[model samples]
Target chain A: MSDSTKVRYLEGHKGPTVEIPTPEGVPLRFTVASGGDRAGAFLLDAFLIIMAVIVCGIVITALMVIDSATASSLAFVLIFGFRNFYFSGLEILWRGRTVGKRMIGLQVIDRSGKPLRVEAIFARNLTREIEVFLPLTILLAGDELIPNLPPWGRLISLLWVMGFIFFPLFNKQRLRVGDLVAGTMVVQAPRRTLLPDLVEEPAEEVASGEMARFAFTREQLDSYGIYELQVLEKILREPKTPAETLLAVSERIAKKIGYTGEMYPSLEFLSEFYRAQRAYLEGRMLMGDKRADKSVAPQAGKPRALQTKLSGKERSRAKPSASAEPLQWRTPEDPPQAASQAGDPAGPRVPPVPVVPPAPPTPPADEV
Target chain B: MSEIALKSTQFRQEREKRWRELERLVTQVEKRGIRSLTADELHDLPVLYRGVISSLSVARSISLDRNVLEYLEGLAVRSYFVVYSPRRRPGEVVIEYLTHSFPQAVRDLKVWVALSMAVTVVGFLAAYGMTLSNLDNYDLFVSPDYSAGRNPSSTREELRAVLMNEGEKVESQSLGVFATFLFTHNAQIGLLCYALGAVPLLLVGLLLIQNGLILGAFAALHEQKGLSVELWSWLLPHGVTELLAVMLCGGAGFAVGMAAIFPGRRTRLESMVVAGRRAGVIAIGCVGMFFIAALIEGFFRQLVNDLTIRYSVALITGLFWIYYFGWVGRKARPA
Candidate 1:
């Protein structure tokens, strides 16, 4: 059977990502960039190489007192070899961010979003002589290059240039000839996102009871990564976000987190869940306790009481409330840190099955 | 503010400052290299990294904004490489390639090397025999310009002078530069042959065979002129190394071409990709061979005129290369 990813690709997403799950259960997504970006970077790199070549040529002819004709020929070799070395060298040394790639906000990474290795760098740059540099060089300077070249030779060169240069446009990922050869990709480098300011929370210290409604076990919080958290935040911020969409997203998250309790308002559950999870995660970070990555979960029915008491890692399975306003969670009544602190990642964290009895409902709060 | 936006905005206001601070520090680390960081800055690196990672995870699961996600992703990746990946100096890389990667690649591509030899040998013998069999086909393969008056019609005396006069027609400094240009040009041709494999490989065959035909025709023409011995002696200083380099590239071309023609359960593109990787390595490793060949041809050939000494040099160099690919870097081979 065809891989589902290819099927989705054929169905047509302009650029699809290869998802590599990190230790945190967040898939570091690498999205393939457009061919135009590759060309842009190449042109920039080529310009730099050519300038260096000119300097070398002048040095050889003037300082070294070499004949101009010989210097030009020597310069040509330097120009060619240096182009290959520059890219392969810089990328491997810097783990795939070249000067041009850095400038264009593009990077070369393994399909799995792993850092690049020297082998791939060599593969791509070596093949580039034919796929990119050769064809481009011929197309641009054919007339003067081999003055008496045969018509067939010229035709082959032209066809060669066109074939490799345009190959990326035809592919779904806009991958160039070298990219195909090396099994590498060019992607837009991710940047820091500036989020809109959130409304200030109540001045009261985080209330243990309010946090109880959104209290998530470390595993529950670990289900989604920072990427997912921002995604949830974006949805929460949308003015016209539909109810069905919210329901669907929250339900999926709830299932993943193993929450099997009564369904609360999806928005309320998510926002309250977001606040609690954020607090829990940040607290762990502050304490230098490693967030339990998805791979290492509390084994079935296994909870360490001593370590849980010491680290105060959140071990509570989710307690989804039946409220409409998750805002009640932001009250600063000294956020129920003690309860979460009492819970450890290795404490009670069975989402599909609750380890503790249901708690009494909190008193209703005034609507914001 | 809407509850979620308020929550998100508050979250951002509380943590964005630290995230930006960490971003600046990380950017500084990246730009100036890790060594440039102060001791205090270095101590704070991981703490800040953890902060960003936590922030990224929280923002990702809660925030709906793609801008924040993108920012976190970029920072996370940069920091990930920074914390985990080893930094390599350019000199280290060059040394690594020369000592380990190149030899290992050459060994791995032994199949292509053998195939290239086969094609070249077949072409050499055929062209060598063709001139012996019939003089009429002489012009078909060997162009007169390249012949440098060493064709069948040339006298033995004229052919013998080619040994001394060949390649020296140019001045010394220009000769080295000219040779370097030829090496680059030939390297381009070798890679071109490999890339042409994507065109269903018809040209790949033509290229390999053309190289063979030229060698064979040249050998045959020299034999006809009764100057074959002198030609062999003259070519020995560089021909063995040059021929091996070209042959390896020819094998690379064939490997790429055959992968396209017969995909062996993979999609044609996938097969080509695999072959392209191998071919890429072969092409890269042998690039220096062209330079070595140019040096031998330009300086050594002119210096070492005696046939026996030239032959010994060829044999020693040939054995050295064989030993290199066979034994060197075997311990450090990548899994």
Candidate 2:
């Protein structure tokens, strides 16, 4: 499992990449944020903090007029401490987001694909003291403090400041000194849409019995998992993907999953394979078991909205409760739910109908 | 067997509903924060998340389609980040960090701290030896521009006067200004030491040596002129904190650099990250040390000319720090 992770990086891909695995062992997909976006977030955060500093400065100045001696030092500590404190505080509380990160649609996450942790946040922001804030402080503030300072001090401070500011540009991930240390990455929040399935309808394009061109045994269907299924799906939907590549992928997958049938066109095989896999997965789901988990008896108690509404609408729950579908009986034609009910001598556990017969030869797609 | 498979359209018909729902909820959470979701939507999120995960699981089990799998994977992750991550406040975070994270990190880098001390000590010893071996070696380490007033040529009485801030008019204002200057100078070196750790090949060791050399050369001059008593009093008032701060910063740098040079079992990046966290914390925390050191050097050092008083103050501060850092929050019950 870990071996594939090491070689996950491919050529031409920029930005920081993280691989998260589901229980099924396939990696989750996410797009890491670009540097410009992060910079924008940083600018927003910097702006907010600067406003705070200004407010603090005003308060300090007022205190100075009232009681000048300690106020100045108090002001310095406030400014110094707040700059370091702000991001770490916000990111940790906000779950790897500051006001700027939230506003800019950026989030920090563990590079290992775990939820963001506090140590990472602390490590990263602490580095910001030297990397982003302190250098600027030294270069600008130090210049004013000691007027007769030697030339070397000023030059060194300036160089140090520039190096930190530009460090992100040199790396694809745009990690600062802090991020590099924490093994955390600032990424855009995940927002990928499921593209419309392009597999042709039986009545629309596929010829009579063409869907059945590549038939497989139940054992063969059970042999492969969702990760493999997605690969096939990607090949079929991606028209731009080459024919040879599709053939190569499907052929290799067929061999690996123990599909013992006469070869059909790659698209037909994929369509058939997709359909069978879908049925099996849906059946399993009805039993209330996850992909890899042991099957449990389906609950007799239907949850709110699922029984009455279209599973899709209930799935999204997009409409407010006021307008949502209130009650609707299960349709006999509902392939998956109907199948779950078919062989339920006891619990409405899914896929049992298909599994009971083991090799109920040539069960129709609708009746499986 | 052939009849068992559904048409491509029917295959999607069975599952697209759940996939689409998850996609929308994920989108909503992404656009607005997760808390923006309605109660039902909130309840539906994990349910749908589990469903989608199951779908991916089944999809893989049957060797299902990629687009569907990709969509579910994306949706699962989106919801995971939102629903799973616990909200926290900045105050809580700061408290946790100060009470545990910062100190734990500091303690972890004790070896690096020692290494940094070694560099400073070696530098001090080498410079002291060179200057004491021959008066000419004084020119090798100490520059006239930086020496303020004391030098190898200065007589014993002059060195003693200068070491105790007795040479000039000893006005408080100039001394304060000079102390502030020294504080900034030390801090700049500290920052440099830590930053240069990014590339272990250069700067980390050199800067510490440079620091130690200057200290050694100055101390050697005073010692040779029979002004060690004056030198000890002058340094003790604030130098204890000031030097510790400098050495701590150097240690932080060495910690970061050592990660790069010797990553141990972890990858280079991983090791650097582990080291960078503790070292960077030490470096940032050391800033306060500098500020405190400056406060004492600027105000208190010049006012009190009594050597015993200065030494006692230094002793109390040193002991206080040892207690505070070593045991202050170790067994605390606060969150």
Candidate 3:
């Protein structure tokens, strides 16, 4: 690998950076995307909640009007079950991406940056039953029963709740136990470039003088045609590149074009050009990860991996990766052989009972 | 771009950021339920997202091309007045606070009225008993020094003639002047009863009760003397505005005391502050009532020497004023 490419790759390994590119001279600054767009999600959730409440209200009213104790109790349970089923089912099925998340450009993916599959989604969402729902139910019932406890059971439950509730904070990735067990991560949807590449029709005559002076190489320009070239450009144009190297690259490009002028194309421009060219040769397209290997042959010692290697700490920290292999959540046909193996009888053996209560519509007053 | 367009664009950008942040929050909530967030995390969400939106708005505003400033100003104003304006719908906190208690503020007000009415009934019966027994006449229910007369019916008539002749210029300089001479003198006693509420509520009620008792005695005496029509003429002219004022003042005072006594979540002092704000508004309303009473006394009462005209005018204006200020005023446009 060229020393320049080595320098380029090293920059990317450092830390998170904005990859979105805008026109030159336009100030590219951090802009908060609208949380309001997610207002719809809140609204959608709220609508569902309101509907549920209204339905429950009507049912309660009807029951009261008729004075049916048994019917009222049944109705209450049914409503509770319905809410849990939909809320948990949607979250798991969609891999943490709710209707709201989808509306607002977000998704849930696994650690490897892949959409969460069914098993992971189920595992993560099902925990809602034990961690949130059951605890609340038990607490309500417990309070009703003991009237007053020795404070031990209450304390234990309180600690268990307090401990689990704040679980997301301790981890950098913000994973709770469900997230950890399910191997999931919530991520912002990768934004697509607004402008597509301009097809370079045979130019009539390169605009005279300064314009033609820094004309991009055919291969270099072609990088812009592919979406992934922007990523490569982002990686290449780093502050760490020596000024001398940039000047040298600029000189080479200028010399090839046979131009001379009072001003020279900036080293940043040249570095970006080379980066784009290299990316084009590698055949990586925008947002396409699998095709990355075929496009660019990995030069020995370059470690041209799709992404930076996991940090040493991360690798060591990962609890012996519960293998990527799918665990059985019963398909209609695949009944468990015995409940032996993982000893997780909490699996397919327990016929799926409704877990979460139907989510009440999000209140408009809530900041959430 | 025109200034409005520029502002609109800026608003749009800020809105977009909020949407993005909300999207992020929802994802977080989905991955982890709301209970899972630490208090700090929960707190941070609003603060961070608010910061992000503000920063974006500032950036967009600064970046705006000056050419569009005027247009942007217009858009901002329009949006301020029209779009993005807060709905007047009752908020959850307010609704819950108002409804949660079984005996609401309005209900309590009714209880006060009932108590005042009871006081009036008992006062008249006591005065009647004194007259029937021919006791050393305690007719007007005031100390002999304050009493203008034991003949309540003719006393009322004489008071009316005095009001007509002297008009607004004739208020007694003494404190008792308001309770005694004014009580049977003008039918506007009702308006005074309601209006005095603008003061600390205790004063308003004391004035109302004092007036009600004296009037009860006077009316009972008038029945004994067989000069009820003469008393009615004297009482009706400005009494409507007076009575309405008293009730409104009572309502205002009740509001203040209630706020002080049961300040949910607020310190008693804080509740007093809120109640004070509401009282200030009601006081402003009382000023108008006072003016109306003064008008009836100065001009209308002078012309309507006939008892019938005075009574009818008082009755109509009294009812209308009471309905308007008491019920309608609650729904008045918030300043």
Candidate 2 achieves a global lDDT of 0.64
Measured against the native two-chain assembly using Cα atoms, what DockQ does each of the candidate structures obtain, in the order listed? 0.22, 0.16, 0.01
- Deviation from native of the Cα of residue B293 in model 1, angstroms: 1.1
Interface RMSD, one decimal, each candidate? 13.3, 12.0, 27.1
DockQ of candidate 2?
0.16
Q: RMSDs, each prediction?
A: 13.3, 15.2, 26.8
Candidate 1 regions exceeding 4 Å error are: A1-15, A46-70, A136-160, A193-368, B1-5, B9-25, B37-51, B166-171, B197-200, B259-274, B332-335
Position B60, candidate 2: lDDT: 40
Residue A330 lDDT (model 2)? 26
lDDT of 2 at A72: 62
How many clashes show up per model? 45, 19, 50
CAPRI quality band, candidate 2 = incorrect
Docking class of 3: incorrect
Better of 2 and 3 by TM-score: 2
Residue runs of model 3 more than 4 Å from their true location after superposition: A1-368, B1-140, B143-204, B263-274, B322-335
Model 1 agreement with the true structure over A112-187: per-residue lDDT tens digits = 4555666667777776666667666666776666566667776787887788788888977777767766677787
Which DockQ value does candidate 1 get? 0.22
- Candidate 2 stretches with Cα past 4 Å from truth are A1-17, A22-27, A46-65, A126-172, A190-368, B1-104, B129-192, B224-227, B284-306, B316-335
As a whole number from 0 to 100, the lDDT of residue A26 in candidate 3 is 18
Docking class of 1: incorrect
